[model samples]
Target: MKVGFIQFSPILGKPTQTLERLEYLIDKGKHSDILVLPELCNSGYAFNSRQQALNSSESVADSKFIRFLHEKSNKYNLYIVSGFCEKSDKDLYNSSFLVGPNEYIEVYRKSHLFLNEKDFFSPGNTDYSVYDIGICKIGMLICFDWVFPEAWRILALKGADIICHPSNIVLPDLCQKTIPGHSICNRMFIVTANRIGTEDNLTFTGSSIICDPRGNILTQASDDQEEVMISDIDLNLARDKSITSRNHIFLDRRPDKYLDIAKAIEESV
Candidate 1:
């Protein structure tokens, strides 16, 4: 399958300009099976206040950006995973959703919010979800969720061949370096779509990457450029978790000894 990411800077509060920029990039890129986009591409990040974020966001069903994406999905006849600022009822969320040909599939709200994001959006309550789209099984996770190994492991256990990470990262090189470790452990392909440019006091680190199951960097973008990073990955590489024929990534597990891990989290929360 063709796996890739689109890296670009989103203009804060200018959804029209940002959407147009994204559309231009998509049109110019090579055809791919699935593509991932940066976090909050529509509404942008680093809001001055919660009210400003809400003003920039709208209900998913009513969002023009989403409508435009729906149109583009059919135009390109490919799957798209993108980050969006979502407004639901009176609460707001930093969320990501999947768009298939002529339809909107599912949404994953950002479970772990970064600095300043906690002041604006509600914590995500959704569980880890994986979708089988015939070609391959795919999963979604937002920016800060990259820090949690358990989250990535859960998706791998759920049979996700590829994990789409939509991020607007600020801390330089931390996630870019750590993701390959996650891919090696889980035996799954990972596409990390990160944005560039500064919003207010924060400067986003680009370096969007695609890593194979063997911990090889298939393709990587520059830390501060607009680029389309793509790689042709074999789905069978992710499905096979065998390390040395005798040892398996999943079969070698010692879950019995890890019960304390769950207990530790319960005590802290």
Candidate 2:
């Protein structure tokens, strides 16, 4: 399958212009089987206040951005994963949605809030989940959740062939290193779509990447530019968790022995 990601800078409080730019990128990536966009691709990140975030948020069911994705997915016969500020009822969430040729597949709220996000968005209630997209079993996780190893492990355990990571990353080295680690350990493919440029003085690191199960970087973008990176991968390669003839990444796990890890970390905090 052909998987691709778009890296671009989103202007704050300008959803229309952002969507137009994203539409152009999506058009450029129409040949890809699956495409991903950066976190908060529509409304932009780095909100000045809670009211500003709320003002910029929209419901997934009625969002112009989502509606455009639906149309484009149907037109191109592609699957799309994108991040946006989601408004459900009165609460807001840092969320990403998976849309296929059929329509909406699933929405993943950001599980781990970062920095000032706690003041504007609610933590995701849904645990790590995977969905079937005909070609592969895909999982979704937003920015900041990459810091939690458990999130990646859970998705791996749930039979995820590919993990779609939509991010607005500030720390370049962390994601650049961690995403390959997640792919190598889980023995699954990882596609990370990160934004570029600055918002409210917070500059995003834009090294968007697609990594194979063996931790090889299939395609990577530049740190400071807007670009689309694409790669063709075999979904069957991720199905086997065995690292070698004697080692199996999943079968070798000792979950029973590591039960105290979370508790110990919580106590230390």
Clashing pairs in 1: none
RMSD of each: 1.4, 1.1
What is the C-alpha local distance difference test score of each model? 0.91, 0.90
Model 2, position 117, has a per-residue lDDT of 92
Q: Candidate 1: minimum summed lDDT over ten consecutive residues — where?
A: 24-33
lDDT of 1: 0.91
lDDT of 2 by residue, 94-212 (tens): 99999998775689999999999999999988778899887889999998999999899999999999999999999867888888899999989999999999888798989999999
lDDT of 1 by residue, 1-269 (tens): 68778999989999999988988887755387888999998989989998899988978888898887778778888888999999999989999998888675689999999989999999997889999988999999998999999999999999999999999999999999999999999999999999999989999999999999999999999999999877999999999999996999899999998887767666967
What stretches of model 1 exceed 4 Å from their correct place?
264-269
- Could you give me the TM-score of model 2 versus the true structure? 0.97
